[model samples]
Target: MTKIGKALGVLAAAVVLPLTLSGTAYADIPFNQPINGNATYYDNSGFGACGTWVNAATEMLVAVPASYWTTPNPNNDPLCRGVSVQVSYNGRTITVPVKDKCPSCGSGHIDLSLPAFSQLADPRLGNIPLTWKFVRS
Candidate 1:
């Protein structure tokens, strides 16, 4: 091939290579896996809102959205009912209830109540790292 043709081929390959590589990298991520995890409540008063409790040892507070509370009646979904949460702080585990909605929670953040905070430990720690799962029972 001519030098010009080879340069064009190289440029095209550069563009196409990234597209192909990124496609495979995206597939490596398990999108099907549930986006479940521990989140901290951003309640200034330290008293978090109401939600569902899940898991056994981990204290994860799944904050319910405002839309769910606005309705005259809400369904008893486990996610909405507050599932048990497992909080891991300094390698210690504490369980707390999922209560209330977090006004500051950005999208996936879960808020917890003061009572729940106490159950896990102290809220002063700020942004407690927790791991949790959704349960049917």
Candidate 2:
């Protein structure tokens, strides 16, 4: 093949390679896990289920599944209240503290404070797919 043809072939492979690959590139977190889910935000006032009132515009916090709060589980006894969680979308990742419970969020889903959501993506995106995992604070 001519030089130009070979270059075109390489370029084609580069473009198609990522499309064919399955799964996204994310941090290699421990526990062999990255929980994938949908993320949304709620603008509200007053205290959260966790009983903490925070400035949503500045605080970096998230609301986990309400089941963890409404239902009794030994595993979350001390969700630590302010445990650090890593939230990722697209290629950006932000670490935020777990500050409340999301009674509406399903398993694997998390509700981020507006500020936390803005850190990883534009609020204009509305809802987005993301991956998250707990990390040592």
Candidate 3:
């Protein structure tokens, strides 16, 4: 199964309720971040590169590949860990934190926690186009 499929299975085992986003996106947050990508979520949470344990209930946790920390990246050692990120999709936005790495994900793909995913788009959508950028932690 694909990584997203596996994650979705994990999500199915955890919760199926969809979260509602409040209000519309604020244009002044300056999410002018250059990075944009697609997003997916998993059910059974696992350990992140940072050595922290996260689960489906963990709010605002995300994963980026190793490249996010290497050259051409500017966030520091743990990549975007602990950084508040603005994820926008379908005119809605939510802020989540970097929790792990997506070894199988491509350059612009993000694996988000179920809770965080719900905040951006409907869980039923499975996958969605998203744009994100680093914000003050």
Give one clash count per candidate, in the order shown.
22, 0, 4
**Between candidates 1 and 3, the TM-score winner:** 3
Choose 1 or 3, whichever is better by lDDT: 3
| Per-residue lDDT of 82 in model 2 | 38
Model 2, stretches more than 4 Å misplaced? 1-32, 70-77
Per residue, candidate 3 scores C-alpha lDDT tens digits across 40-127 of 8875666666566778565568776555554233332335434556788999988777767677888778788888998877889988
Best by lDDT: 2
- Candidate-wise lDDT, in order: 0.47, 0.69, 0.67
Off by over 4 Å in 1: 1-38, 42-78, 97-99
Name the regions of candidate 3 deviating beyond 4 angstroms.
Answer: 1-32, 71-76
Residues 2-45 of candidate 2: C-alpha lDDT, one tens digit per residue: 99999999999999875443112112223225789878876665
lDDT of 1 by residue, 62-99 (tens): 45344324322233222334344444445565554444
The pairs that clash in candidate 2 are none
Q: In model 2, what lDDT does residue 68 have?
A: 46
